[model samples]
Target: MDTQSITGATAAEIADSIRTLHERGELRAGDALPPVRELATRLSVNRNTAVAAYRLLAQAGVVVARGRAGTVIAGMEAVAQEGYAAGSVLRDIGTGNPDPRRIPDASTALAGALGRPVLYGEPVIDPALEQRALEWVGADLPGRDLRITVTSGAVDAVERLLAQALLRDDAVALEDPCFLASIHTVRLGGYRAVPVPVDVEGMTVEGLRAALAAGVRAIICTPRAQNPTGATLSPGRAAELRAVLADHPYVLIVEDDHFSMLSQRPYETLIGPEHRRFALVRSVSKSLGPDMCLAVAATDPETAERLSLRLSPGTTWVSHILQRLVLAQLTDATALQAVAEAGRHYAERNAAFAGALTDRGLPATAADGLNLWLELPLEAKTVADRLMRRGWLARTGDEFVLGEQRSASRHLRLTVHDLTDEEAERLIDDLVDASR
Candidate 1:
């Protein structure tokens, strides 16, 4: 190794440099580190110095080494920086999102309690946080035998559940025009999402039956506020689905209640007691706040065991600080009220937009979620084009649906929360004129 090539820095100094690189995302998890000899030659450090630096990184949990193979960056979280290319803060009318300000401010008393060192070897899920989550879902869950698991978020829970229950090429039934994240997750994990039709009452039993007949091994259903459509699974429809799936006892059922806290509709779970395997995922992204990155995954004990395996100590775990903060906020009576009030506000605003559109002689559907899923008289693209000219951005329903027929439902998903009174009226007028 050429010792003079670099500044001949000390092993500790060399390690610190590498650590800095890791921290700044220059190196990432799963990236293979250069061989010690190669690194020493490049950095002009002694072979022993390079080895010592690598050893220090290993001890610090920043990297892991495999005998004879080599070392790789470890313990880093995956953060995908996509979609935000549109800018950090546009009017944000395109995304079906909740207000970050609506999240209850963490109490000073709770913040003061974190003065003690949060040791590295702590339990992945905090006890207090778990209890709070149980209180949140445990009360509403139809079955008494339900078990609880806290995931990083709804997406994390869905991914973990799919991993536990599905193999490559395994078929899962998902509502057509389902949650975009669900479609993407199944696709990335090499599973096929069989598109089931969603109707006015929510996921139709006939569509589910067809999906099951197509030999789907598992099902991912949204019980409340089906994404884009904002159709909540009604109790009558839920019972019908439970009966259809009753014969297919072996198939796993995963219900995503993404709008659980914000839902103005009735509570309807399709997981029957006799059904062997299932999971209930509730996310606070729409109500408490999207950035909170918190979700509760309630399931049977067996499913919980599998999910726990995915959330192992060295694997992905929700931050203790974040969990504590959410728990503190949720436990407070005033904080819960804030969440409730915010949910009502989103629903009211969304409904008002639908009413405004209807008043302007545009076809509109009143829904219970953060967005308005409108059925336009012309193609969604035509409406979107007209809206864009008026300085508005809207996501067409085509983006949310699956299959070859991406021409769309002459539908658009409008983020109604960001709509101002004048903007809302102008949009209605424009949509009416365009439809005609």
Candidate 2:
């Protein structure tokens, strides 16, 4: 087809044409577009207009610029959303959930929260809750001018933060084996995810640097108990990442400390003190319960003000009662003890399971948080199939990968903390047999 028939004079028209071609499957994923000069000549447009057209396409997640390699189609297909899989007779180890038995009862706290009337137009966050949240989150953050915002959950806070700061198709740096919610939010928002590979010490410095060079507008990182991998950021690794990010002061940095009180490791961060745009989010779900659905966001002033636009009084404020309940549970001695004990329980159980696996001649180690990231000798799907046959269900690592690289992973994220001693032993034996 002639270039004039395929495209148009303006940048917007050219972008639309490319998008249409991609939608119609004519421009497949990884297919390179004609070079900027060639396209400009063919379309009888200025070179800058062609450049603008390509920039627009990159922003919309339709294509990616590979620097020296030229631009290629992104081919970002929506993976299956992660949540509770359908009911099965098999024991499910795939759900990345905390042990229910360990969750403290909030009945008394909920009753206390209901005693006072919470009228609209009152402060969005409870006064007492705000004080506690500031003190709690501020203790870990390095910034002096921190502002707090409360949202429905970590996912909510992240979505709002990105919406306020980024335009559609802006590149976001995300850990390769990313959290399910993070993946869903980025894809649904029409942003391209620049995959930053994660290791035992969290996101690698080189991976992050490369993403930044690719012009990522924002970064979302898990500082501890990273979902699916249970990887925590080490002190050394955190320092290295911060050094690299120092050059890009305005790039938004969001640290999702989802495991907060439940983690056995210390929280490490990537946001340097002088960093212009950043946020650290701590969710109460893992420590309290998922039903709580509360997260406190600590961010720079400008980001906080922008995030507040979406969270203001009338539109979508988190319930005051929930905030009070969280505050009550946080301060209550009994509840604190219960939460501490729960943390210990998860750590001990995971450690015991890892030891058992090691004793059985399998190389395994429990890292952190509610799940164990088990690396099997075979593909995770093969192991999952054998596990299903043996009446156990587990999440494979493939579901967590973002970007175009969809190679089968050898890892499986199993929430084995809820299993009894006997049950864990049997499962480990089954896993070993399955690998063979």
- Please report, in order, the local distance difference test score of every candidate based on alpha carbons: 0.77, 0.89
Worst 10 residues of 2 by lDDT: 1-10
* Candidate number achieving the greatest lDDT relative to the actual structure: 2
Each prediction's RMSD to truth: 11.6, 3.7
Clashing pairs in 1: none
lDDT of model 2 at position 16: 94
Error (Å) of candidate 1 at residue 209 is: 0.5
Lowest summed-lDDT stretch of 10 residues in model 1?
76-85
lDDT string for model 1 (379-428, tens) is: 88887877777666667777777865677558887776766788777767
Regions of model 1 farther than 4 Å from truth: 1-92, 107-122
Cα TM-score per model: 0.78, 0.87
The number of residue pairs in model 1 that clash at the backbone is 0
* Model 2: per-residue Cα lDDT over 216-273, one tens digit each: 9999999999987889999999999999999999999999998989888998899898
Q: Clash number for every model?
A: 0, 2
